[model samples]
Structure formats: C-alpha cells, structure tokens
Target: MEAYWRRTAMWYGGVGLLAARVVRNLALPPAYTRLVVREMELMGVRSLGVAMIAAVFTGMVFALQSAANMARFGAEAYVGPVTALAILRELGPVLTAILVGGKVASGITAELGSMKVTEQIDALRALGVNYVKRLIVPRLLAALLVFPLITALADLIGLLGGAAIMFFERRADPWTYWNVTTYWVLPRDFLMGIAKSVVFGVLVTLIGCYNGLETEGGTEGLGRATTATVVHVTMAVIVSDFFLTKLLLALFW
Candidate 1:
C-alpha cells in the first residue's frame, strides 16, 4: 500500500512538473499555431452545441426545482437570485468543465496514446522535434482558452433558461426575475466561475496529455490511459471546485 501510494504521488508530481515547465515556456511556433487553431476547432466549436443544450436544460431544471421549493415558503421572489447565483457560481463552470473534460481529455489521450504506441512520437523525437512543445502545448493552450469561453456561454444560456422558467412556466412577472438578477447577483460570482473554469481547463489538459504521453504496453495501455484521463480530470475538477468555493466564500461572502 505504501509503495502504491508513493508511486502514485510521484506520477502526479512528475506530470505537474512537466506541465509547469511547458506552460512557462510556451511560445507559438508556426506549427504550434496551426495545431492550436485545429484544437480550437475541436475543443471549442465542436462542443458549443452540446454545452448550450446542457446549460439550458440544467438552468430550466434548477429554476423549476427552486421555484417549487420557494413556493412552499412564499419565497418565490428569491428565485431570480437563486438561479443567478447557482448558474454563475456553481453550475455553469462545473457543467462546462465536465463537458470539456470528457470531450477534450478523452480525445487527447486517445490521440496521443495512439501516437505513442505507433512510434509516431518516436519519429518526432528522432527528427529532432520538440514533442512536448509541438504536440502538448498547442492543445493545452486551446483547452485552457476554450473551456473558459464555453463556461461563459453556459452561464448566459443558463440564466436565460432560468428566466424562461420564471416567466413562462411559473407565471411570474418577467421583470421580477430581471430585477432580482440585476440587483442581487454579485459580479464576484462571475469572476469566481470563470476562475474555476480556467483551473479546470488546466487540470484537464495536463492530466489528459500526461496520461497519453506516458502510455505503454500498446493498445491496452492506451485504453487504460484514456479511461484514467477522464476519471482523473473529473475528480480534479470536483476537488478544485470545492477549494475555489471555499476561497470565494472566505474572500467575498
């Protein structure tokens, strides 16, 4: 058990160090630029529709649930604040991160792992290319930038979803929702959500790429790394959410 724990810690630590080095030295070479653009297409544009749909449905569900609960206590006026706070601080980034983590991380792991197993990475190395900078850096940059953008979009869509529920489904005056949103929702919530999304983006990219690059033992190993990438990124997202929440509450609330 101790040996297992030690190896696990070292694995994570080594990956963290490698990622830190890569991020610190990030310079957009021409090929890297092309790769980043391609990744943006895959990570951002590809996932937009799913993120929008998920955000809308989640917002609707939150509003309906909150309304039902608040109705019992004659606290329906608080619905707008509730919905806004939930979407801005919690749901938007968290949901968006999950979506991106699954999509981007899995794809990256599979792709890189395949390259590793097929001797493509070896070929790059033999040809005197910087594999980390050429491959990992561009994708990392794309995921980091795109995840936060998606989170912002999700927040807006979620707010709209909640507004629809309040105005159409619950028969509340639209002004009530708008008024409460304008008055009660704090700007810090928006900042916190975006910050959280940025951290999640970093986590997803680093873990996914690390797993892919480290893959061994051929096909089965690639499959294992892909699974591990998703699981690790998801867990990291949840953990980061908790810490960010605590920090925000301490500093802002």
Candidate 2:
C-alpha cells in the first residue's frame, strides 16, 4: 500500500514536471506556428465527423428515454430542457473527449512509440532539435484549443438531434422545445462544459505523449503503451469530470 501511494505520487509529480516543461519550451524557439495549425487540423478537423455522430445518437437516445419516463409523470413537456441540460452540462464534453481521446491517443502512442523503437527520436536529439517544442507543444496546444470548440459544436448538434426526435417521436412543438432549452440553458452551462473539455484535452495530450515517450521493448512495448493510453485517458477524463463538476458548481452554480 505504501509503495502504491509512493508510485502514485511520483507519477503525478512527473506529469506536473512534463506540463511545466511544455510551458517552458513553448516560449523558447522555432515558433512552430504551422505545426500547431497542422495539429489542430489533425486533432480537431479530422475528429468532427465521429463527434457529431456520437452527439446526435446520444441526444436521440436520451430524448427518447427522457420522454418515455417523464410522460408517465406528465412532465414530457420538460424533455427539451432536460436533454439540453444533460448534454451541455455533462454528456457532450464527456463523450467528445472520450471518443477523440481514444481515437487520437492510440495514434499518438503508436506513432511516437514506433519512432522511439526505430531510434528516430534519438536522431532528432542528435540533430539538436528541440523535440518538446517541435512535437509535444503543438499537440498539447491543439488539444487544449480543439476540444472546447468540438464540444460546443457537439452541444448544438445534440440539441438539434433531440429536437428532431421530439418532433418525430413525441410530436412536441419545435418552438416550445427550442424556447424551453434556451431558457434553461445558461451561457454558464456552455462555459462549464467547455471548461471540462479543456481539462480533458490536457489530460489526453499529456498521457498520450508521456506513454509514447516512455515506450520501450519494441513492438510489444508499443502495443502495451497504446492500450494503456486509451484506458488511462478514458479513466482520467471521467474521474476528473466528477471533480470538475463539483468545482464548477461551487464557483458558478
């Protein structure tokens, strides 16, 4: 138990140090602005289709379930607000992070792990290239910037999805649904969800890059690191969501 606690402390300490290094390196040199834009396209633009698909389906299912359950209590009219609250406050950010994290983390770990195994990273260091600036900073910056944008879009698409279901399945009035949703959902709700996504974005980028840089043992090590990244990032996003929700509620709610 003591050993476990010590290891946990060390793990977090290392993560903090890495984050600090990322900050320091960003201001140093090369000013890889193009690379940052490239990463944004890779991490954000490529990820849009899946996030929207997930959002639409999630909204549909939630609206379907909520309407069914609430109809029994004669509260079906509130389904729009309920769906909006759930998606904006919790589901949109959480699901988008998990999906994009899982998709991108595995790719990052595998790509970097392969480089490590093939001594390409060593070659970069030998060339006097600041790999932290060249690699990690762009990716981390992209994640930080991309996730909130994606989540905001997902939130809007999800509400549209729910509205579609309400119209088709429940025959609820669309204007009423839209009005109720707008009334209940404050700008704070959007901000809260975006804030949570930003944290998740940081966690995903750091964990993925950390695992990749630490990869050893060649092909087998790459496989293990890739798998571990997905699991660790998913757990981190979810567990942190609870704490972030609490903190945001205290500050804003």
Candidate 3:
C-alpha cells in the first residue's frame, strides 16, 4: 500500500513538474508567439471538420432522445434546455477532449517517439536546439490553447444540432426554443465546461510527451507509447472531470 502510494505520488509529481516547465518555456515571447500560431493550426484548423461532424451527430442523437422522452410527458418544450445543458455542461467538452486525445495525443507521441528512436532528438541536442522548446512545447501550447476553442465550436454545433431536430422533426416552436436556450442556460455552465477542457488539454499534452520521451524498443516502443498516451489521457480526462464536476456542483448548488 505504501509503495503504491509513493509511485502514484511520484507519477503525479513528475506530471506537475513537466507542466510547470512547459509553462515556463512558453513565457519566452518569440517562442510563445510561434507556439501559439502553430498550435492554432494544429488544434483549430485540423480539428474543425471533425468537430463539425461530431457536433452534428451529437445534436441529432440528443434531439431524438430528448424529443421522444419529453413527448411522453407532454413536456417537449424542455428539449431545448435539455440539449443545451447536456452539451454545455457535459458532452461538449468531454467529447471534444476525447477527440483531441485520440487525434493530437497519438500524433505527437508517434512523432516524438520516432525522433527519439532515430537519434534525431540527440542530434538536436548536439546542435544546441532545445527539443522541448522546438517540438514538445509547440504541441503542448497548441493542444492547451486550441482545446477550449474546439469545445466552444462543439457547443455551438451541438446546439444547432438540437435546434435542427426541434425545427424539423419535432416541429418545436422556434421562438420558444430560442427563448429557453437564451434564458435558462446559465453562464457558469459554459465556463465550467471550458475550464475543465483546459485542464484536460494540459493533461493530454503532458502524458503524451512523457510517453514519447520514455519510449523504447524502436517502432514497437513508439507504438506502445502512442497507445499508452491515448488511453491514459482519456482516462485522466474523465477522472478529472468527475472531481471537477463534484466540486463545481457543490459550490454552485
């Protein structure tokens, strides 16, 4: 039991230190600016299509479920708030992080692990290039910065998805849908979800980079690291979400 606790503590401590180093490195102006641009490209532009697709499907499915359920109670008007609350408070950020975890985490880990195995990382060291600054930091910055934007996009798309169902299949009154969405949805809900996503982004990057740096056994090692990065990141995101949700619910309610 003591041994397990020590290992767990060390693991989290290392993650914390890595995150701190990433933040410190990001404080340099030129490097920070470049990372921001690079991150926008990697996280935002690359992820737009995926977010759109997921959002549409999520919205559609949500509407189908909510409309069916609410119809039974003659409370179909509540569908808008149901969808809005679900997207803003839960599904939007969580699903967005999952997508980012799969897309960004695996790609970064594979790239870095391949470099580490090929001795390119060593060459960068020989040439006085800070690999963490050049490679890892950009990705970390990109993932951290872009995740919330992606979540925001997902939130909007999901609402539209629900709205589509309300307008078309459910034949819900558009004015009522609009009014409920605007009036009943709390601001804190969106803020909490976005805030959770940022934490998830940081965790994803840290875990991905750590896995890549620790990779061994050539290609096999790289593959293992990539897999591990995705799995651990997804799990961490969910676990963190549970705690954050509990804290927020307690504080707010």
**Candidate 3, residues 56-84: lDDT per residue as tens digits?**
79988998898998899998888898899
Q: Identify the candidate with maximal lDDT.
A: 2
Cα lDDT for residue 15, candidate 3: 75
lDDT tens digits, residues 1-253, model 1?
A: 9999998998889788978778665864545678889999999999999899999999999999999999999999999999999999999999889876788899998999999999999999999888888888888788778988999999999999988999999999887679877898878889899989888888888888888888998999998989888888888899889998998789888
Window of ten residues with lowest summed lDDT in model 3:
27-36
Off by over 4 Å in 2: 1-8
Instruction: Please provide, for model 2 over 110-160, each residue's C-alpha lDDT reduced to its tens digit, 9 standing for 90 to 100.
Output: 888999999999999999998889889999988989999999999999988
RMSD of each: 1.5, 1.4, 2.3
TM-score of 2: 0.96
Give the range of the ten consecutive residues with the poorest summed lDDT in model 2: 7-16
Off by over 4 Å in 3: 1-13, 29-32
TM-score: model 1 vs. ground truth: 0.95
Off by over 4 Å in 1: 28-31
Given candidate 3, what's the lDDT at residue 188?
A: 91
Judge candidate 1 at residue 241 and give its lDDT.
Answer: 94
**Steric collisions counted per model:** 0, 0, 1
TM-scores of the candidates in the order shown: 0.95, 0.96, 0.90
